[model samples]
Target: MADVFDQIEWNVQKIFDGEPVCVHVGNAMECELKRHPSYPKFHTEAVRAGVQPASSSRLWESLIAMGRLSDLDGDCTWRLVILDCIIPSLRSVSARVSRDFRVDCEEIRSDMVATALEAWKDTATGVAPRNVRDRMVKAAFDAAFRQGKATSSERPMDDIEALSWQEPTAQDCKPRASSIIDVDDIRDADVAEQIRGERAGAMLQRWGCFDAVHSFHDEIRSGHRSGSAGQAVKTSRSRSLISNPNLYYYSSDLYPRHIGLSEAAGVMGIAESAAHRLIRTGQFPLPVARVGRSYKVSVRALMHFKDIPDAIIHVDDVENGALHARDAVP
Candidate 1:
């Protein structure tokens, strides 16, 4: 059996190493850089281990979002600067920076870190805004997705036939505007059409009116005659094609059911006499008690008597009768 100290160390080591690769969890692979006082030893060790330091842009956003960078305290900024300076030496391998992803990877000077942080604090509330930029970017992405231009090759662009740069003149510089249009008028027309259809459907199903009920039944039975004619149009256009060709019939109405939970509990202890009394009475404070799968006569008696100094109780039977017996302890 492992000693208590050995068990503690084992648990601690497991937390640091994380679950094995077989777990396939996202956060499992992410590792953090360790801070040290000596630069030479730290740099050499980090480089040898191929530990890459996180970039400033990503780190800044993360810290801000986690509320750690709020108020931009001088001490906190200094720590960040130290981490930033050591990052290049710790990085696994260098790669060419692209124009789209380029960030000024300048190593933050230790002396200036405090001043920069203080200046940032003075300028703003030291709080980063709730990322409206990300929301806007996602909206643009969704728009692209809806337009069927998500993939690079599927994007619509005019071919060689539309080229007109050679004949361009000052006349094209004039501002061109379209004719007057009422956006609300278009919405109103669509709303009116939907309302009219709904009202017609309701009138056909009206109660206390024999003609209306008969009309409703007739419409319901006649629906099958229309067959696939009323299905949604699904045709490939010039640049984009309809992805999902399956026609989904509209559901008229639906009501969903709700789910609830029941509370339950299990009890275990060592005193054979006490365990027997409780099992017989079923008087444990825990409201919903059940005999657990792991419950064993010997194990329960030993566990219950563990609280007492010198009492020794041993159970031999593995069956449920012994487990739930009137004299069984824990």
Candidate 2:
């Protein structure tokens, strides 16, 4: 009864609109727009099928296509596709990755391309394409893992044993000084804290904080005055922190101890005027409590410590840290 294009459009729309005839991030019933960018027409016809917006039929096909779902041939029904081949592939596609992909992060962009290829392979025509994508994804992951691995020093085997022992046995250690400088223990804090004692001592010794501050200051002045910053509000100590071998102890973990320090330290290196400009534009990674021009905009010659939580974070870490396990909720 319907025209062929209309039929094709309707079928496609049904695929997009009906409860995803596949599984995606979760048991969500939303349309699989990311799986098929041209799914709007298909969604329109799904409404005609008496399928509610919450139905999985609308999302399933795209989910399966994206390799986010597995067809349940045994049950003769659709369910979330568990990544059975998890050890070889880290089941890396997740809600966080999906959301980030929607927002256009580089890693997420790479992941979606990987997913699209996997989805294509489900059908006979896409076999070669899927193989190509599989190889690419493996290469990308291998490269990333190696890069992450390379940023560390060769730790003495005994030091690793000590740290590993601390993980299960250490009831959160209270630093000797009971000062509020230890932001890691604070509850409900949103920012990170200062690196005190040995950590700060080492950084100050190796990098010379004042010189680092001046270098970052010059970068900020040059970038802002010359209009060449291009989103990189460069930092000397921050760069040092990233590159330092001493700090590598925390680098391998999800919530690196140093990040808490970096978040709390604020931009001590920049001028108050430059800091104010950077904060207004949200270019600075540090948080600002107020947004008015009258604020002096704290800039210290030494790193000023602010109290923040140990676990407080943005969505970006979800991919960097929590890509394992089944807890990702999109």
Candidate 3:
């Protein structure tokens, strides 16, 4: 337990590094300490030393009470009080994003902590009890998603270019033409190119070339209209690929499963209205994916609010021949 405490203290120092600690964050740390196996021993020792356990869940409260009992005193002890809370919350956010985006959790967590600390330091009073974690997580999520999209784009293009270089077979070269609009019908080349580019971008987006779609969008925004009429025609053909039910075939599988607002509220132990208020105020730790008029919450994201253990199962437990022992009398 001393080793565990020492490790935790070291990790906390690495996280905060002399930053001012917030009370809520301190309380979070106390809760984390309570989860440790040695906490009961520490608590019993404190009881013997005439320190009453505080009713409040605040870590600072517990630490102050215990500190008085242990005869151990220091400003460093007080400084680390809130780190238990902040580190876990940041870690939870990182884990959720990493799972969703299939990125490295530790990398994201480090970046988020750096961003949060910088933002925290920039504040006039150097205190942000509520918004700090949310802002850090959101920024981290955006960066991770962008990286995932960019990576996805690069792999497919390599395969596509390789396939394009192959000699066309009789079947491959066969005319598979759709209804073609006459170029004579269009007057302005720029207008034609813009229309075509938009269509191509939409098609790229549907095909999950999100980065390519973004690149095309940037080109359009930058007003580069130097391409050939064939390019315009290609753009026109591609741009009209609007997302239909068929287009979103894998969206359900690709996207994370989301719970309703009621479920989210229940998990947080708050009223539905309060949950809605938090979302409306932009203070919610996780972002709500808008599904039409309703907001859908991620179950993974909700896990961040609670102390749940990893859902792993071991194979050795059922090896005792309990299958044969069952219903022996029946």
Predicted structure with the largest lDDT when compared to the true one: 3
RMSD of 1: 30.3
Q: What 10-residue stretch in candidate 2 is worst by lDDT?
A: 79-88
lDDT of 1 by residue, 18-132 (tens): 3322111112245343322233442244223322222213433342333334224423432232233323421211111111113221221221223333433443453332221
lDDT of 3 by residue, 107-169 (tens): 655555455445534431443323333343344444444444443322211111111123445
Judged by whole-model lDDT over C-alpha atoms, candidate 2 comes out at 0.30
User: Which one wins by TM-score: 1 or 3?
Assistant: 3
lDDT of 2 by residue, 234-318 (tens): 2223322232222211211221122222222222222333344344444443444453424322222111221111221222222
Each prediction's TM-score versus the true structure: 0.15, 0.19, 0.31
Model 2 residue runs over 4 Å out of place are: 1-124, 127-185, 188-191, 195-212, 218-330
Q: Sort all candidates by lDDT, best to worst.
A: 3, 2, 1
